[model samples]
Target: MTKTPPREALTLAAAMNARRLSKVFVADQLGVTPAAVSQWASGHRPVPPEKAVKLADVVGTEPHLISARYAELQTNESGNVVPIRQAADGADERRNDLVIARLENDVDSLRYALGALVTVMTVHRPAEGAAVAKAIRKHVPVKFVKQGYVAELLGVLDKAGHE
Candidate 1:
């Protein structure tokens, strides 16, 4: 019989820790029993591809990492072995900071766009339809506006203006 790879097991363990997800919760999310989750974690059984991806989602880890760890665990039966390589804590912190910065920038841009929409709709009520549309286009991408979120925002603005 083939052994579970170390990387695969470590990845699964790391994902659980990173996500703060319980083994029982992950199993429930995957529609499996907690015993199955434990088995996978213990490297006694291999996780199927589809279930592995679902497990990763529950664990908030990439599916690729879980797959790699599963392979590593197959090679080492000790179960205590580390299968995945983890970055230094400082490096992890830096990556999280970068993620937060990007999220903040996105929020700021969205807020600016919403403000522009409100400004154009309220103060410039007599403006031509094309001008209002142009202002919206300038603030938000055409593709992004297609999902009706822009319309919803405009509806709110209109209601707020009335009250």
Candidate 2:
């Protein structure tokens, strides 16, 4: 009786097989050739970081799950030298922090512009000021409008409406 060797685990090929996806289909989704997919499937080449994320999306898994290189990049970016074999919650938190920081910056810019707009409308177009303020409040979060220039604008609009 002949015994087959144990199959390698934690491989891209395994992930694809579990999803029941063919190499040609995956290659088409990734805009790569079937030969390229074969190389990755056979573990002859590591998936490049640029392609890793897209490949993960194609396979319905996280990049680190399918690509050691992506996991290495995440581990290194976190300022740790320890090799990670899977995605960690800490990595997700770090990525979320980056997105939140960018959104906060954009909100700050919007606040400044909205403040200037309110001031202009109040001075030259008093009748339109309340409408504009209402529109702004409707679109912006309550917490945002409750502070800073937005707060001042709402206060002014309220007083104007009362008088």
Candidate 3:
């Protein structure tokens, strides 16, 4: 298994106290639960590098470097928040894209299967039963991941056409 990153023993509470701030105020500023702030202050949980870096400015302490993951949030002496080392972000986006592509493929397969079924019924059935087949075809339901419920009548499924 991969090793976990090192955690800094941050004097978060002291820093907050020096800045004349309360735990709730610091917790609100960090967008974390008060318990998390308490944990960080009491050394129960190590300070996250991102939070450590962010709190450096707020608590007047040096930004503790933890790992490459926090490099994206690197702030310069000019104090500009630069978005760098986006490889991890890119990987996540690629994974999401793959999932969406697979879902679209599944939808396409479902539509094709329904079309074949409609075609077989429409072709094999006699002229007298054409209206019944047409009705059944119109009533055939297939689910989609997005765009909600829909029915493909006469072998046609269009998102814009329905909604």
Candidate 4:
């Protein structure tokens, strides 16, 4: 019996298939080594926020999706913003803060987009709304959902549904 040879692993193959992005291209764009990109793609290393932003830009995706840290940088129990990484120096720290603020703004925009989707689904197709919302909830971070906006929107949806 002839044994089949093991398939060779292609670096960043999924990204290449989905977005036509190669590890070399991403490494060049991010000023990092292909090995670093491979580490991130393999989930062996966490992507930093700044690099996550650049990676998302290169791959045409959201930073939160790339960086676990950014995804967890949501409001706290006291409604205070969670702390992000602090730079060692002054200017870098300020810049990092600005990036964090921008990320928060992006999260707000995502929430608005989700709210619109939920509104449309609930009003146009009640049955599918719950399913769509469930799928979205599964993907979104728990802290983001616990922000109270989703619940408030659902209350409005319920009122509309009853009428």
Candidate 5:
């Protein structure tokens, strides 16, 4: 009589069997070298932290069992040793903050241009205002108009001499 082997030993092998999931295919899905997959499956090396979650999902197993060091790769971009959890959250926040700042500046510039356009259209050519606005609205959507960018839309009228 023989005991059943643990699931980890058979995981990648099973995936391979299930749908002809080849080593190259699995490596592509997991963003790893085929050699890395072979080493992990053979128990020569523990699965790396980044690949653990995806590999666990692929094999339908809990992540911690796949790799004991599931949370921390303990290496930084500059090669300094640090807990990934600590740096990861801060780096994500900084990226979000930078993106938000850039978007805000872009919207501000749009608003200033819109204000200038309104001054040109209504003050300069008040009579043909409706026609000029309609022509510009053909290009700019209603959302921008509601967001107070109607003036930029109407700025097109200035170029076309619609006024």
Candidate 6:
């Protein structure tokens, strides 16, 4: 039995993900079983050079990147995989910042919409009430409305006292 080339194996996995190609599809295309594809992906069986070229074409990626990554994986087989902590941390921070910005924008927009709805509701009756109710009901889920029932009751009392 010949040892499978590491680069070929890694390239196969990367190509699978990058192309969004399934093992079943690849197997069918390659005239092989899904288990065989799985083995190749797991680095147990290296893809042959001819198959590697075909995979690169199918995956729409430069064959070199896949080959290089595979080589890197081969060199790092000392049982200690370097953790991509910094990249993960950076990704997490960026994700949090985006979530915060989105939340801030949503809050601002909701407040403005709520204020406008209140003003419209005050000026217009029956028709406007129905429209505003529809708008609110559209945006606010039944579960959320039910959860806020108590707060809503308090808000009604607060408004009554102020008026």
User: What would the TM-scores of all predictions be?
Assistant: 0.38, 0.42, 0.35, 0.40, 0.35, 0.33
- What is the lDDT of every predicted structure here? 0.64, 0.72, 0.54, 0.64, 0.62, 0.57
Q: Over the full model, what C-alpha lDDT does candidate 5 score relative to the true structure?
A: 0.62
Worst 10 residues of 1 by lDDT: 74-83
Output the lDDT of residue 69, model 3.
34
Task: List the candidate 2 regions with Cα displacement exceeding 4 Å.
Answer: 1-10, 76-163
Worst 10 residues of 3 by lDDT: 154-163
Put down candidate 3 lDDT per residue, 73-130, tens digits, no spaces: 3543355433333334465455446557768999889977866755554555435234
Measured with C-alpha atoms, the lDDT of residue 26 in candidate 6 is: 81
Tens-digit lDDT track for model 4 on 7-50?
A: 11122235445897788898999999999887777766767666
**13: Cα error in model 6, Å:** 18
Off by over 4 Å in 4: 1-89, 132-147
State, as a TM-score between 0 and 1, how close model 3 is to the true structure. Answer: 0.35
What is the per-residue lDDT of model 2 for residues 1-163, given as tens digits with 9 covering 90 to 100?
A: 9533223214677778889999999999999998888877776677876788788788776776666765655654545533233437675666556557768999899978977876777777777878877887999899978997778888887666655
Report the CA-based lDDT of candidate 6 relative to the real structure.
0.57
> How far out, in Å, is residue 26 in model 1?
0.6
Residues 1-163, candidate 1: write the lDDT tens digits: 9765556667787778777878888888899999988877767766765575577678877555666534333222343322223434454455456557768999889978977766666666634434555566679887775657676665555455555
lDDT of 1: 0.64
What clash pairs does model 6 have? Answer: none
Clashing pairs in 4: none
The TM-score that candidate 5 achieves is: 0.35
- Candidate 6 lDDT tens digits, 63-106: 44444432233222254322223234354455446557768999
Off by over 4 Å in 6: 1-91, 130-140, 147-163
